[model samples]
Target chain A: MILAVCLNPALDVTYAVTALRPGTSVRVRSVQRRAGGKGVNVASVLHQQGVAAIVTGPAGGSAGTDLTAGLDSAGIGHRFTPIAGATRQTVAVVDADDATVLLEPGPVLTNAEWTAFTTSFADLAHEADVVTMSGSLPGGVPGDAYGRLIGLAHAAGTRVILDCDGSALIEALHDAPDVVKINEHEAASTTGIETDSAEGVFAAAEELHALGAKEIVITRGAHGVAARTGQGRFASTPAGTVDGNPTGAGDAFTAGLAAAMAAGLDWPARLRRASAWAAAAVAIPTAGAIDPGVATDHETRTIVQELPA
Target chain B: MILAVCLNPALDVTYAVTALRPGTSVRVRSVQRRAGGKGVNVASVLHQQGVAAIVTGPAGGSAGTDLTAGLDSAGIGHRFTPIAGATRQTVAVVDADDATVLLEPGPVLTNAEWTAFTTSFADLAHEADVVTMSGSLPGGVPGDAYGRLIGLAHAAGTRVILDCDGSALIEALHDAPDVVKINEHEAASTTGIETDSAEGVFAAAEELHALGAKEIVITRGAHGVAARTGQGRFASTPAGTVDGNPTGAGDAFTAGLAAAMAAGLDWPARLRRASAWAAAAVAIPTAGAIDPGVATDHETRTIVQELPA
Candidate 1:
């Protein structure tokens, strides 16, 4: 079973409005609330793909209770460590024209709560085959907390996937992970390499691989993704770009990669599946997971090109 | 004892922001939530004035829970009738300059719930000396529900003070309430007498009184208030107007008038106390209640001018 950790979770509230006028009242046509955090999204997607995955995180207050109910309704297994503070809420105001205004930065977690969460994290990792650490650390959580979890997963004989950025990602690289899926910007910031070309991206990925990552996947929206493994390097672009919502494409890719790896697929196949899932996700508005039939169709026809190492 | 019924209560949330920009995320600097509804405000102000007042209303959901807790913290007695639907919330965006944009039309109550509320209304009125029916009726409630409440109170020997406008006020007048407090606009709308002058306002109040009201009190913000009683007509203006929030001035005036009448104060004295409370309320940022000390000071020097009937 796969386990995912979302250190900072949020109650995502989406408000659909015909038009938003400043300093004026607008009627909300509809509202939807869901549990949202990168790891939660990834685990939810994995569950949708018929994979056994459990999501663990910190949750509190009425908003947190609603988030737990939401995860249960979606059939995503979850265990939340109770915190003293209320769970943070992210408000997304979506207009008729599909424009979105996201108000984020949810509740802050204290050190005692962070410590309690880590205990749950250790237990979940001990029982899982693959452990994925996703999203930002809440306040009071150490920046290197993800790295500590990576170390714990390694000792437990669980494969680790690091899906975070900046300092946290940099620190996690010190303890080599099986895979690191980062966007182009995060990759540049971590390696301090200017990636203006495919070669530059590959060079940055090599630098990260040297630091400890066994494999690196850099996703470039619309331009496709580049992956570097011990076998070699590969690049894949979607057949055609689709105009759609791009909110949860990366999480979809992470879910696809983890599922492929769990199925014992080789590095090349995993990259191909990840790219296909991401492209299909971009075609749909919802995050992380798409229909299995759509994902299969997109994967079967996706063109993953071999790039010279 | 006085009873105030806010059939349609709300958790009024005011978000203070630097400025409101359309289609952009805004960081709310401060958030203030209060128990809100016309009758609830009046009850709170009366409680602050050391009067024995109880607030009864329909409250549900988390927002309702917060409102109940707030009223309890303020030492105000209340009984909430739980309903199927959640209590509505009104969001006011107050900019740095204190300009407010109000969102209206709170939650809709069910028909069965409205019946239950009316039942509670009669029981409360039967035990009270005066009943003040305030605010707009939520959807599913008949516009004449206030009229029905006035009839119930009148039959119970409880002096009914109606502080609403439009159809509700007009409908309540058929019951001949002991007192009706309306602004210039509501008086003009109900009586079809333009209020361009004090005579016009008094003419509108006279028409409402003839329609069955025992007394009429018309409040003019900053300019003070005018009242017409069987004894005669009295007008009182503040010595000097202070610039502050005017959100709850009218409700404060109602509370002051109710308190004076309950104490058997003369018409001129009642008008003086009511105007002073209204002025002090407008000078404070929050609605309804004034500081006890401020109210005491204002009562000492408040001036009343008798007008020829």
Candidate 2:
């Protein structure tokens, strides 16, 4: 079973309007809301792919109740610890011209809350074959929260997938998680490199692998994903841009990678499968959903190149 | 007790940012969510003023749950009819420079839900001394819903305080409610008058009274209020601008007016107390709250010029 951890969950709200202007009230055309966070999104993708996955984290207040109830409605297994504070929300005001996202800084986790979550996570990790820790920790949570969780998962003989940035990602690297996945911006920020080319992205990956992660995956929006593992270094790109909303492409890739790893696929095959799911994500309007049989019907000639280490 | 009806209840989510820019992500500096709608705001102001009141309307889904829970947390009384669709959210992206409010047209109420709510409202109206029907009707609810409610309230011997705009206002006016309160813009829209001046507002109030409302009240932002009753035509203005968040000033005024009406105050005193409440509302950070002693000490040299009708 795959376990996805979202330390900071949110009620993702999307407001559609004909146009947005300053100093005036805009009549909203429509609104869509859903439970969200990188890990929760990954679990959503897993459930859609007919993979068994459980979503867990710190949830509380009415928003938390909504998030858990939403998960139940979606048929995704979840066990979120109830905390004192309300979960956060991410709002996107979309018009024909653009989509403006407002991300709220989540609730601050008290020491006791973090400790309780840690105990619960360790027990769940023991029963999981693959554990994916995604998203940033909320305020008051130690930056090394994922690193600490990695240690617990390792002790339970579970393979860990770390997907985050900043101090959290840096801290988790010290434990050498099985896979570290990130987007171009996070990769560039980590290495201070303009990863606009394959060489630059490969340079960032080398740095990540050297830091401790056994395998590294770097996703480039329309350009697809590049990876480095003990077997070799490879990059794959879909034939062309599969445009829609690319918000959860990376999370879908992570879910695909986890599925591939659990299925004991070879390193190159893992990249191909991950790319298929990422492409599927881009072809959809929402983040956590894919076109019917996107991965199965993925006939796109994704060019895979074996880059030198 | 005052029964405030908010047909389209909302979770008012305010996101404060250093600045707002479209097509990019903004990190929210703070988030504040409250149960909101015209009647809800009126009820909140009454609660703050130590007035007995109960709020009710159609509520459902997660946003509804959040709204009701927030109302409970705020110590306000509410009974909402549950429905299948979620209640809507109105988001305000506030910055130091400007506040952009996005108002969502709430859920499409099924015929069954509307009937259930109408039944519930009639029962409550019978017990209410005054029924304040405010806000816009949600989708799937007929434009004359408030008019129908006014009819029900009248049958139940409840004095109706109508506050709305467009077709709803026109329809409710036909029911000849006890009082009709509205902001200058709404008054202007209803009567085709540019009510930016005291004379213009008074003219609009006269038109409303002629249209069958026993009494008329028109709020002019920081400029204060003007009224027309059987006894006389009167106007009151704050000495100067009482600047802050003016979002709830109208609601506060409605509450003050309802309280004065319930206390059987004279027309001039009712206008004065209502103006004081509105001014006090502007001095505070939020809409439904007033600065303590402002109403008592509102020595704001308000000149009440008795207008000739």
For candidate 1, give the docking quality class from DockQ: acceptable
TM-score of each: 0.90, 0.89
Model 2, runs deviating above 4 Å: A183-185, A191-207, A218-227, A232-245, A292-294, A297-309, B183-185, B193-207, B219-226, B232-245, B299-309
- A1-309, model 2: which lDDT tens digit per residue? 999999998988889999888557899988777899999989999999898999999998777888898899999999898899889878899999998899887888899999999999999999998999998889878878898999999999999988998788988888888999999899999878789998898889988888888989998877777888888888886756676877788888889888888788887778877888888887888878876567765524667778776
lDDT tens digits, residues A258-308, model 1?
888888898778877887777767777877566565578768766777777
Worst 10 residues of 2 chain B by lDDT: B295-304
Q: Which residue pairs in candidate 2 collide?
A: none
Cα lDDT listed for each candidate: 0.80, 0.85
Q: Point to the candidate with the largest lDDT.
A: 2
How does candidate 2 fare on TM-score?
0.89
Worst 10 residues of 2 chain A by lDDT: A292-301
